[model samples]
Target: MVKNSGEGISKSVLYLMSAGAGLVVANNYYNQPLLNLIATDFGVSESAVSNLPLLTQLGYAFGLLFIIPLGDKYPRKKMVMIDFVFIIASLLIMALAPNLLVLIISGFFVGFSCVVPQVFVPMAAQLAKPEKRGRAIGVVMSGLLIGILGSRFISGFIGEYFGWRSMYFIAAGIMLIFWVLLKLKLPELQPDFKGSYKALMQSLWGYFKSEPSVRLAAVRGGLGFAGFSAFWTTLVFLMEDNFNYGSGVAGTFGVLGIGGALAASYVGKLSDKMNKNKLITIATLVMLVAWCVFEFSGHSIIGLVIGVILVDMALQSLHISNQNIIFSKNPDARNRINTIYMVGYFIGGAIGTTTGAYAWQIFHWQGVASLGVFYTILILIFHLVFKKSLA
Candidate 1:
C-alpha cells in the first residue's frame, strides 16, 4: 500500500473510499425508519422518540464543526480509523441500550462518529488530479447519497424482520469490517496544517471571514439541503395520510432516490467542464420546478416519483458545483472549508425537518410543498445576489 503523499489516487482507491464513505454515513440514518419500532420496544411515545433524530443530527453538526477540521492537522487515515472504533462502540451501545435515554446518547455518538465520511470527501478531493477532482468528489458523494437514501430501506426491512436492535448489531459488524479495510488499504495523508487544535479551530473563523466562496457556497448548499430535507421528512406523512401507505411504502422512496445517486457522478463530471454559476442557476430552477410538481401531484405516485428524481438530481448537482468551487480555492484547507459548508448544510437540514413537521401539522402535503419551494427560492436569491461576487 502506498503511504506517501506523492502517490496518485488510483481508480481502485477511489472506489474503496467511496464505499467506505457510504458505509460510515449509513450509521446516522439507520435509526430514521426504526424510530417507531424503537419507541414501541422501549414503551415510549413516538413524540418522545423523535428526540433521537434531533440529537443525532445535532451531534453530527457538532462533529462537522469540531472533529472534521482535525483532518487538516492529523493523518486522515488514522483519524478515520479512530472514528470507526467510536462508531462501532456507539452502534453497540444503541444495540444494547435498555431505555430511550441510553439510546439517545448512543445515537448522538453514532452521528458524531459518522462524520468520517466528511473526512473522506476532502481527502478524495485532495488526492485527485485537478482535472478529475470534481469527478472524484462526485463518486464519493454518490456513495454518500446512496447511504442517506438507502439506509431507510435497509433499516426498515431489518427492523421489521430481524428487529431494530439487530440492525445496530449488523451495523456495528459492518463498521468493524470497514475499519479493517481502511487500515489495510487507505493511504496515509500528512497533515496540511501544523498547529494547535485551538488554533486549528480559530482558523475556521478566519476562513469564514476571508473566503467569500466558502460563505456563498455554504449558504447555497445549506438552503438547498433545507428544501431537500423538508420534502423527505414530510414524505412519510404524505404517504400515510393521502395514499394510506405504511412505513414500508415510504421506505421505497429511498429506492426511488437512486436516481439521484446515478446522476451525482455525472453531475460532478459536468461541473468540471461547465460554468459553475450557470450550473447553480439551472439546478436552482430545477429544484423550483420539482416543488411545483410535488404541489400539483396530489396523491399520484407517478408524480411523486418524477418529483423525487428531479429534486434529488437538482440538489446533488448544486452540491457538487458548490464543493468544486470551494475546494478549488483553498488547496491547503479543504477540510476546514468543508467543515464550514457542511455545518451549514446540516443545520439547514435540521431547520427543514422542523419546518416540515410544523407545516404538515398545519396545511398537510400542500404546506410541506410550499415550505420546500420557499427554501429553494432562497437559494436562487442567494445565487443572483452573489453571481458577480462568485465570478
Candidate 2:
C-alpha cells in the first residue's frame, strides 16, 4: 500500500474512522453492565465476576504500553485489520465460553485488541492538515467518549432482552462488517519508525525523557482523568445512598454526558487558536467547580445532572488540549507520544477508582467529593506552576 499525500481527510473517511473507533473501544465496557448475568450463568459470585472488568482494564493498559507503540513501526491499516480479527475471535470465545475462567480470559483479549482506537487516533492527527489536527482528533475522540458512555446502556438493553452472549455475538458480527469497510475505505498509513522492536520499545522511554511537553501533557491529562474517574466510579453509590435511586437512575447520567461529547470538536477548535495552557487552566478550574457542585448538591438529582455536564465537558476539553500540545512536539512520534500520554492517563484512572472506592467506604459521599476536589486541585497547581513551560 502506498502512503497517502493528502492535505485533509474527507468527511466520509473521518466518519468511518470515528464510528470504527467507537465500536472497537465499546468492547471494553460491554461487560460492565452484564456482570450479573454473567455471574448467574457461570454459577459464580458477583465478587468473582467483578474481576472481569479489572482484568479487562489491566489488559487495556498492557496493550497501551506494549502494542500501541507498534503503530509507529508498522502499517497501521494492516495492524488494525489484524487486531479486528483478534477482537472478533475474542468476542466469539466470550459468546461460547463454557466456564467463568474462559469468559474472563476472553475478556482480557477483548480489552487488549481494543487498542485499535488508540491506533486510529494518531493516524487521524497524522492525516489532517496541521491547522486542523486538533479538530480532527476531537471528532474521533467524540466517538470514543460516546462509546464509553453508551456501551453500558446498549449492553444492558441487549443483555436483558436477548442474553449476554447475544450481545457478544452481535458485536462480533459488527466487527466483521467494520473489517470489510476498513479494507475498502481506510487509507494506507506508512510507518515512520524503521527500527528493531526492542529499539522501538526503548525509544518510548527516550521520548518521555527528552520531551518535557509530553511529560506535562501526560501529567495534566492524567490528573484530570483521575478526578473524572473518581466521580464516575462512585456516582452510583451516591445516587443509591443519598437519593435512594437505583442503578437505572445512575445510568441516566451517562446520557447527560453526551453534551460533553457534542462539545469536544468545538473545544478542539479552540485549542488550535487559543493558548493551550490557559485553556487547560480554565478547564481545570471548571472541573474544580464541578466537584464543588457535587459537594453541595450531593442529594439532588438535578444537581448531579448539572455536575455531570460540567465535569465531562471540562475533562474532554482539557484532554483534547493535552493531545494537541503533545502532538505538536513530535509529528513522527505521535503513536509513541500518545502511548506515553495515555498510559499515564489510564494509570491515574486506576488510582482514582481505587481511591474513590476507599473514600466511599470511609466518609461516603463527602469523602468521594473531597477526593475529586483534591485531584482537580493537583491539576490546577501543575498548570499554574508550569504555565510558562507548557506555553
Best by lDDT: 1
Clashing pairs in 2: none
Please identify model 2 stretches exceeding 4 Å from their true place. 1-6, 35-50, 96-103, 160-163, 237-247
lDDT of 2 by residue, 1-391 (tens): 5354267788888878888888898888777657667778888864467567666766777789999999989998888888888999999999999998998898888888889889878888988888998999999988888877777667767776788899899999989999999999998888989999999999999999998888887888888877776676667567657787544555567778878988888998999999888898889989999999989877778888888899989999999999988888687888999999988887787677667767877788888888989999998888788777645
Name the weakest run of 10 consecutive residues (lDDT summed) in model 1. 1-10
**Count of backbone clashes for each model?**
0, 0
What lDDT is reached at residue 13 by model 2?
Answer: 80
Q: Residue by residue across 1-391, what tens digits does model 1's lDDT show?
A: 2333255578888889888888888888887777667877889864467677767877888999999999989888888888888899999999999899999999988888799889888888888888888999999999998888888788878887789899999999999888888889888788879889999999999999998888889899989888777776667657767887756677678888878887888999999999999999999999999999999876899999999988988998999999999999878899999999999988888788777767877788899888889999999998999879757
